[model samples]
Target chain A: MYVYLYDTFISEAKFQNTIARVETRLTDLGIAGKICRLSVLTSIEELVNDAVKNGAETIVAVGNDETVSKVIPLIADHKVSFGIIPIGKPSRLAQLLGIPEGDKACDVLSARVVTKLDLGKANQHYFLSRLEIPAGEYEIQLNGQYTARSLNPNQTITIYNFDSLAPGVVADRSNPRDGQLELIFSGGESAGLGRFFNKDSATESVFPIKKAQIQGLNQDQSVIADGYTIINTPVNVGVARSRLKMIVGKSRGF
Target chain B: MFTKDEKNSSESETIIGPSVQVEGNFNGEGNIIVEGQVSGSLKTKGDLRIGTNAKIKADIEARNIFNAGEIRGSTVIAKDKIELTKTAKVNSNVKASVISIEAGAIINGKVNMSQEAAEESQPLELQDKKEKNNRK
Candidate 1:
């Protein structure tokens, strides 16, 4: 059975209209499911747990990137497969998953093509996209054996679980399911005539690590994971042991 | 003379400009050009070019290395070749399959061009090693 989780933050009128259209489409496609609304009192974890107890085989999120991020860790190691029907602006995760917005997303749900993907964890929270760290000097210990230090305060560190985030930055070694995280450090000024002309040129250094400990930060530094500020500096980031079974559109690219 | 063709033939995947300073372990798969200062180790599958103004204080391993700057400490190992321009001032052990040094370049360490050097320049399999050994 498929259970739909709808975000209640959207306007009630628009939410009802969207659900009406989506339900009609699902009915036409012969897909049976129940839609559950998320509110202040009902936490996402509670709703997911209830759905699982009531025999929900697939839990589809009908909201934006935040909704998807909230639902991933809840259903990560469970037997239920996850789906998405993006409904808000800035639905980059939906686009990355190749799920169309609105009524088309219903078709994707009905199609039900599933694949396993890796999840990145910082502390207790899980993220499917990437983490953006501000420019700073950091001491990185990789897999407990190799240690590296970054002295440039202008360099930005990014840890990616998948290749969906950071457009134009080419990561040739990024594989989402390969059980490794890609760490990219980019900084420096433009060279020669470009610098004279005020061009933005920088250097990018890439590394593939299984587990990393990042130190050398002030206590107040915040780390942004999936567009949300989750924790402060001196954090540990790595690929989770569990994989997420995700339903994607046919054109889904890693 | 290093021709323009030689400089532009292989595009650098990563470029470090003159104003930046990096002190970390860098591992990647693309060619890199460093015009700034790096104080740690660098590992890449592609070629590495140290520009004339670059100052390096780390061990480096790459497929090919073209140096025209100042390097100190550790060893510079390349699988294919290591070329030092006239402005290059290197003060470390050098190892490669082929080594070329300009007449005006200053070198203050041993240079080894042999098959063993080429094998040592290959990508390290650190994931399988049991003990921690720093490359100095």
Candidate 2:
């Protein structure tokens, strides 16, 4: 059974046509199921719990990255296959998954090209992308053995599960299925004209880690997950679940 | 059912780019390329490349080492080979199966090759006995 969870913003009148077209296409493909709108009255956890109890084998997020990130932990816990029908703009997760926007996403979901991916968990929140934290405020201890700190205090340290967080940034070393995360430390000093002067300076440093602890976070420093949620530190992050089954298109970026 | 582009092949390699300073023991299971400052120690089971702009002050161990930087440490051990490029300035006791030093590279410490080190690893009393037997 497929149960679609639409984000609250989709309830606006501007998205009516897109939602209708998506439903029509889903019905035509014989993959249509119950659709639930996210609202302030009903909590997402309760809805997901009910869907699981009602025999929802596949839980699909019919919204954006924030919507998908919210339900990832529940889907992984229930051990159900997940799908996404990206609708609105800034659908970076869908772009990375190779799923097109609007009704076209229904085709990818119906095709059922499932792949298991690792999820990055910081504290309790599960994130599919990466964790970007301000550098020098924290020290990351990798695999509980060695520790790494920023030599430069003004940079940002990003622990990437999927490497495509920053578009056109193109640091392609992180593999989501390998059960390890890539800790990328890039100094902001080499941004505009500094790159010209520092010809020999390396722009990025990559570290592969199985487990890590971000310690020494102050009250002001926050770990941003997927560019939306502010995950508080000190953070304990690793592969919370290594086998998150999802429907992915052929052109998906791993 | 999905076949994403597998263009990026997996390489177990670490890059310590320039303008970064790393302290403590930096250990890896694969190849490592250093272009920065590593103060404590650097060890890897695979090949190690010290880039031209790198300034490392750490004891090093690896399978094969290619140094083109500055290393001021105690010991550098390589299981297979060690190649010092023209810009390398090393101050450590180096040991390897095979060693290559390029022009303009400066070495300020003792170097022990595989053959002499193999003989030196034997018990001293046994080595003296062997020397006596060889004289006869």
Candidate 3:
């Protein structure tokens, strides 16, 4: 199948060399010479233009999920299958697809099988992840560092914490019934608890939800989706119903 | 059904740094650690980790989401575990076989722990449902 490669040429000195190497490998694999257009982009607008102009039946996004995120909206309505040769820092979607690291992605692309999947919505915008509100008066230490705490809602006031700042305060408002969006909230106990204790709290309030109407938050709040951040708040996210056609390799048997 | 031993086994843990942000659906089969923010849906057969500063706003379908951070939206599928640490905060509905919440964790949402088939393992049920609907 003819494919278009959307390569995000990160201008970092090291990345320039890395991009060259990837191009060389593509040539060695015989993909560069035939069946693939290594579409390189320096800007989002250029990325869209190049992709539209290439007119390749399949789009093999060759960066991390962030790069793919840029193209998702462009291709959401178009009939195109997406393939990923993930080489970026973290390719969550690629990892999920079991697309191997480095050059091995060639094999994944070669053996990929197209399957239509559901897409999510965030306030009229189509995305893999929806909008989010931070926890109430919460502080967490990850990788031994404290960050993004100021944005968090203060939980000392129980009402503000539970009513306005919690993750799923909008379940009823952002329902996931259409079968695309999967609303999520993150609060529970640590992993070390025994099975019984875990069950109790999980059964209590604050697990996760399908839809909701969150209160007391807006665009100022940050949300993380797919692997991209800086999402506007007061966001309403849901499923887009039938929207994406993904090309999963044979190993997954999708 | 194939035995556990027959399945491909890998043990590399991926870390999504706090600076990174992903905005799309994610489905995978290996262990994932999220320190950054994620929006959209996540589904994996392996373990999932949410870093302290990480924020996610979407549906989650994974074997487990070891929460040390924050999440919002719905948890459509978590077959194994959904652990929330003291610093964890989540406000959303959850559908999981197992879940854990720590003393300081703040959670405000509904959680359903009904015994249900894993999404991938429900092919037979789906086929049957389709057949039944056709008959109807």
- Evaluated with TM-score, which candidate comes out highest? 2
Model 1 residue runs over 4 Å out of place are A135-155, A163-165, A171-174, A187-201, B1-36, B40-47, B51-53, B102-104, B115-136
Candidate 2 segments whose C-alpha is farther than 4 A from its true place: A165-171, A190-194, B1-12, B116-136
If both were scored by lDDT, which would come out higher, candidate 2 or candidate 3?
2
Candidate 3, B79-112: lDDT as tens digits: 8777888889888887777778889998788877
Point to the candidate with the largest DockQ.
Answer: 2
State candidate 3's DockQ: 0.03
Candidate lDDT scores, in order, read 0.76, 0.81, 0.54
**TM-score, chain B, predicted structure 3:** 0.72
| Per-model root-mean-square deviation over C-alphas | 8.9, 5.3, 17.0
lDDT of 1 by residue, A1-254 (tens): 98989887654675668767888998899876888889988898999999999999999998888888788878876888999988867688887788899888999988889888888887767788788887665667765645544444556777888765454343344556888787776664545675567432354555567787777555667677887646676788889744888889876657
Cα distance off (Å), candidate 2, residue A10: 0.9
Q: Which window of ten consecutive residues has the lowest lDDT sum in model 1 chain A?
A: A164-173
Better of 1 and 3 by lDDT: 1
True-vs-predicted CA distance for residue B101, candidate 1, Å: 3.2
Candidate 2 CAPRI-style tier: acceptable
Model 2, residue pairs in steric clash: none
Interface DockQ of candidate 2 = 0.42
Ranking by DockQ: 2, 1, 3
Give, for candidate 3 chain B, the lowest lDDT window spanning 10 residues: B1-10
